[model samples]
Target: MINNVRRDLNDLPQSLRNYLGVALGGAGLVFWVIAVRESHFLNMNAYGLVSILGWPFFVGLALVAAAFTVELFRAPLRSMQLTILIVLLVLFVFGTPCAVEPVASLTSSWVHAGFIQYIVQHGHALNGYDARFSWPGGFSMGAVLVAFAGQANAIGFLRWFPLFIELSYLAPLLVIARSSGVSRRAGWLGVALFYSTNWIYQDYFSPQALNYLFFLVIIAAVFACWQPKPLASYGPQSGFWRPRLHQNRNLLTRSRWEGLDTTSTWTSAATLWVLGLIGIIMLASSMSHQLTPYVLILALGACLLTRRLGRPEMVLMITVLAFGWLSLGASDYWVGHLNVIFGSAFQVSSTIGSNVTGRLLGGLSHVLIVETRILLTGGLFLLAGVGFLRRSADSRALEVLAGVPFLVLIAQSYGGEGLQRVVLFGLPFTGLLAASAIFPLRTGAIKAILPAFSFGRFARFAKPTVRMAAFVVVLGFALATTVVRGGNDSYESFSKGEFDAVNFAYNHVRPGQTIESVNGYLPVGFRGIGSVSVTTPAQRSSTSVRRVGLRLLRDRPSEIILSQSQQLFGEEVSGYPVGWEASLESTLVNHGYIITAQWRTATVLALTG
Candidate 1:
């Protein structure tokens, strides 16, 4: 293998290098699957990120990253094949193998599948169903696709959907990174970093995941079409502000005067096509997800401010579409819940406290995982700051893009989960700038940092070693992410028996009969959204399990579910003590609720009046 690598390195055939690159990546993926196959989902933890996957997977990832880095630096050509493989391996290395039956890990994936199922069965979306169902563009799309694929429902898609959506993100991300004014090497590394440190779990089979792809594609289109031509620059004052009272024709006209000759019919037509495509994507995104359209609006606004986006009207159009859709199409969502929409508009600290600080209730290992997440996020921002200081690239596009997502905080709390979504939206840009901090595109920057190094004969030899070192650093982040990203899978993941128990209860219960759970972390209701109703009896913020148990008994829900995941969800989310579910179960038994069905991982009880 070493001899083959040396021969390839020496000869440097483009075809051979590309083939070798993919081969190495494929081998890495195989090694990763082999390593992960040995472990059970029950045994996984933050620590298992290192111990469970074994050395072979990490070694495989390292080889793959190294090969991609070498190919990118050496060839510097367009190749979707390599990028696609890298993205697949990055996303699915842990996910595809672990996406076993029972629809576990993330409880929300099942709910999303249910939403799709509802849409597929019925011709239209269920109005007043839920806030998420109101923005049912993604679910509708999923339903259409499922029907096209001859699938009855979206349940089969839930397990590997995160990996699928993440892999889908790679195409547009590469486009954004390449045009981000970073070198090819830095672009690839940035992509790696984006995947590596993505501990944010928004990639579940949800609207956000689908809408995020639209967001990336739209941004990539903007970057690809509206880049500042060589030596052509414009000021932000034109786009940023205008005199409303006074007749400022000059300012208005100047803002419209994006200094480029569009007399060429081809250029004009192509620009129109790109803008039209972006408009369509923006509309789709607006209809699909709530927070993302707002985020996209702000991101486009930032681009306008930075003069990267030419048509200032594009920003206005997007804003109108997003707000217009909310007002007319999704009126059911905000008509009664106006406070939920505008409550956290200005309460930034409160939002963070609720989303971040409130989630810290867990075991020692869980707490450590959360802390590590904080550190990783902070470290990325710090590196972004360093990138700003370093200025590895000629354009400040990435810097502006990185800063724009911060403004999303002031818009809404997104039900206290806004900050988490903020991290995810900012990650792609942050990863780019962060990569620049480490593997600078300009050789001159490297010389500046390592001043004693000779830039003459030894530079050739030194460059490969530096790239390898950068690869190792990126691998470290990936490994860390693999650990914390799904660290909660121990209690979070459901079993097949849990699914069977829920299915049995669903089969027995009639429509409109309420099925109550302490938490929604168990896999249920995905196949019976319209046929059955599910509710969580306990307030997520309430810490008293006894009070919750009393509420359940008093309400006398028609049916009840208690799953292992629900127990852990109670302990983790509400800070309930271990065996709180058991305590609640005992109370229910004493209250004349009889266990109608039981599975190894779950139980169903009926209220007998």
Candidate 2:
């Protein structure tokens, strides 16, 4: 049967096969468009985007994965066809939310827009306003973009920012994949897997997103510029019979260090220029984000230890820049909030509890999403480990690069998001290793670190079976990614009505007045920075309508905006009863609050005298 399948595949002309790949890619995109058009935001339920996404989405994803797998096995890979398929897959995975939703998701993205607006209007960052402002490099850059684009504010950039930045990541990703001691097939597969499994929502319109690009570019440059020298072989008489300590000493000798040193074919001037560019990027990263610089430091140290990085001083430079900014430039953030900065240092147990166990507090559907994420991450790492064992390479740089990010957890937890950030930092390398599991190289630039594992006995069965297996695996991950990636869209994504309601509230509410919501899930922060205060039930102990009404009556906010997204968060995540917002609205009306404005998806209540 397998032979028949192989013969059938081989019978097709090369041009026909190329045309077929393109046709499948186009069909997948068409199906995705149909899926997006059919999806209704109101239909989304506790299962999040999967509840609203139709069958066409899955069909589209499967076809794209199949096309990619077919291209992977072609005799001479058509780079153009592979590129088209990969981009289409990226669109299906990362661009779906951008297209289906009426407004950009994430209140934080909206808040970031507001920060950019502040910089554009005030000619500088607002001091003593936000901890994020202390790291104002990205915002400053956004301000420039806003002015250059002739846009009044950064709001216009919010809706499609996630997709744009994710697409931008592909350039550096290509470099890293091709240079990181992997076969061409594994490199391409790793890139696809990276996009397929990237459920982390950090790619929104934020500093971290830009800083992440810097992270990738820096790593890519390092890998591209250098290759490790072959290690020298030791004779049995020299150290085979010596004490373990003596053997260890021999391993640490200056000659050994020279052997581990990396060499590059680039001219001296070019090397110097690349080093300078890396330093500038590191400096910018240090100023733009609190955590990425440190992550970069760890990644560079890993490379140095594994002999992939030739310059040890690069680590010192980034560390100094990161700390220098923290102490001198971002003093406002860490001075009074020292505990917020270093309180969780070395508290691995508590950090894990907060990052993992505490996050499992939502409803069953949410629990399923979180559990799926955990399992997917664990499964990817396990595959990477298997790849490490199966593949033969000169250095273990990929393994070290993927593993060292965990060390960040010991230093600081980054407000329980430490693990997620760790995963993000390690994801590219992990994807490479995972791809090696499926399509490993038998030899590289130097002696193999491990004996190459052979599947020669099953070679006949392997091609057909492995192709099908690869297709299934990629298809499964794409499907699962579509589910968990948008699993929070129930509350995270907003509608046109919600956006309009928040705009209405912002325009009417005066300075010193307060705006309140059932929760912090609404799109409310794109305007009204320090002048108008906003509050949510996130800190409240009870979410009961009566309890919430009592608290609101006492506070007497000038205006309150309630939206569908916030309501869904109350019901789905906080486990409040369905229609809880309606009951809360009634309770507010019974008091001094009057319905001043209303939309299909949102409402505004004014505190009437």
Candidate 3:
């Protein structure tokens, strides 16, 4: 039966195989759409990826992955294009259909859109609007695009922006993977692993997302200008270095420290042009994001250390640009609050305790999802380690690239998201090394074949069976990581009704009227620029809730708004227990506040005499 299946498979035309692959992938997408469309958000598991439709989706992914592996091995030339399409299908097709209203995935998406709305309407960043606005390049760019498109506001773009940003990453990532010294097969698998394991939601429409693209593009360009040596050239060389005491005499001398330089694709003049282009990108990134510039600087330093980059002056130039932007353009954010900038530097324990350990306090389902996420990340690193051991000669580029981002971990907490940012910045490189684990560069025709194991008496069947198994592994990781990445959507995402309630409140509130909530999860301040004063105390602890309400009452706010989304957010991410919202409501009622308006998802309480 197996022999017959193989014969039948080999007899089919490549066109038929490609068509079958697309058909299977499309069927999976359809199943996912039907499942999400028919199901309600409340019914989602801890991870949003699982539903009655997930099984079919998994089967579909299996078929698609199988198609990718088969086509890659059989017809290596056109495999990348097909594989990229498959990647887009996996990363985007499931999510794009539901992009209109905010998903339970993130509240920041709405908040970011609000920033763009502010920029578009007023043509200026509001003073003390938020720290993100201090570097308003990305928001301003969004504003320009929105204005050019003649859109009413930036809200419509939020749902689909993640997909767009993720797809945009493919080209640069492929370039980086291909030229980073890995073989052709490793490069393809690396790119695929990147999409599969990228559960980080940094691809949302924000400064980080935009700056991350700049980061990738810059790295890709640099690596392109100086591609790594072929696998054979990585062998040892016998060179006499200067005496140990003289080594420190001139640290800038590359020839004395390392061997002869390899040929770069770009001439010295073109290299200068690339460096100038990189400087401009770094400047723009500096204006757009607070963290990515530093990330870029550190990554460039890593490239220099590996001898993959020749321009050492480029590093110092980027540093000046980043710090210059912080001093001049973003002075509003850190001028008086210098402590916030430097307080957590080197305070790794405190940073972790607050950023990581604190957020781990959640319900069982949330805990499970978080643990799964940790395991998934750790598993990737472990694979990279194995790949490092298995193929030591051809991994220096990936290793240095992957390891450099850890420098960010030591610098600052990025307001508890530092680790996440680090993982995201390193993902493209780490994914490359991780792929080397499954498909280490081989010497001959078998170089195309991915790594797979066989048991006793079945070794002869390993080639075909292992190919199918490898695809299965890839598909499984993609599906599981998708579930873990988006699992929090049940509580984190908002509904259109929720947005309507917030919009209605904004329209009704007059300028200077205080709009207060115990938590800032609702879509507020997106429409009304300087029209109202909205306050949600940064700390939303149960003890602080009453204090915030009393404080708002003291200030004589025009309206107090609360919503089901806020309540859920507090319970889930904020560590508030159940019934916290009701208690606050009871407190409001006792203070002579009347319910002026109510929606299924939100409520407005007006202060009465």
Steric clashes per prediction: 0, 0, 5
Give the per-residue lDDT digits (tens) of candidate 3, residues 1-609.
Answer: 656777897788967865655565566556555555555554544444454233545555666676566655554447545655556455443353254234423667777787888888788987776788889888898999999999988877777777777788878988897778776777777777788888877877688988999999998987888743332332343433322223223335654124123347888898888888888888789888989889888888777655466666667878998899889888888888899899889998877776667667567767777887778888888887876654534226577778888787777988888887888888888887777776666542112223433366986675666566557656767877767766666555666666777777777777877787767777666666566777776354444555766775676667778887677666666667687777877778788888878877778888885
TM-score of structure candidate 3? 0.87
Instruction: Write down the TM-score of every candidate.
Output: 0.86, 0.95, 0.87
Residue lDDT tens for model 2, 1-609: 869867886798867866877888889999999999999988888888889889999999989998999888887887788888989998998899999989899999999999888888889988898899999999999999999999989989998998899999998999999889888999999998898888888999999999999999999998988777664444333332343233234345554444346778578899899999999999899999999999999999877766678877898999999999999999988887799888998999999988899778668988899999988888888888878876767667898899999999998888889999999999999999989888888785333335655578786787787788778778887888889999999999999998888888888899989899877788877787778888875564246656666778788898888888888887777778889889889888988889999999999999897
TM-score: which candidate is best? 2
Q: Comparing 2 and 3 by TM-score, which wins?
A: 2
Off by over 4 Å in 2: 236-260, 444-458, 540-546
TM-score of 1: 0.86
lDDT of 1 by residue, 422-450 (tens): 88888889998887776566532111222
The C-alpha lDDT values of all candidates are 0.72, 0.85, 0.70
RMSD of 1: 5.6
Which of candidates 1 and 2 reaches a greater lDDT? 2
Rank by TM-score (best first): 2, 3, 1
- Using alpha carbons, what is the TM-score of model 2? 0.95
Clashing pairs in model 3?
A: 47-487, 48-487, 103-493, 104-489, 104-493
Give the 10-residue window scoring lowest on summed lDDT in candidate 2.
Answer: 239-248
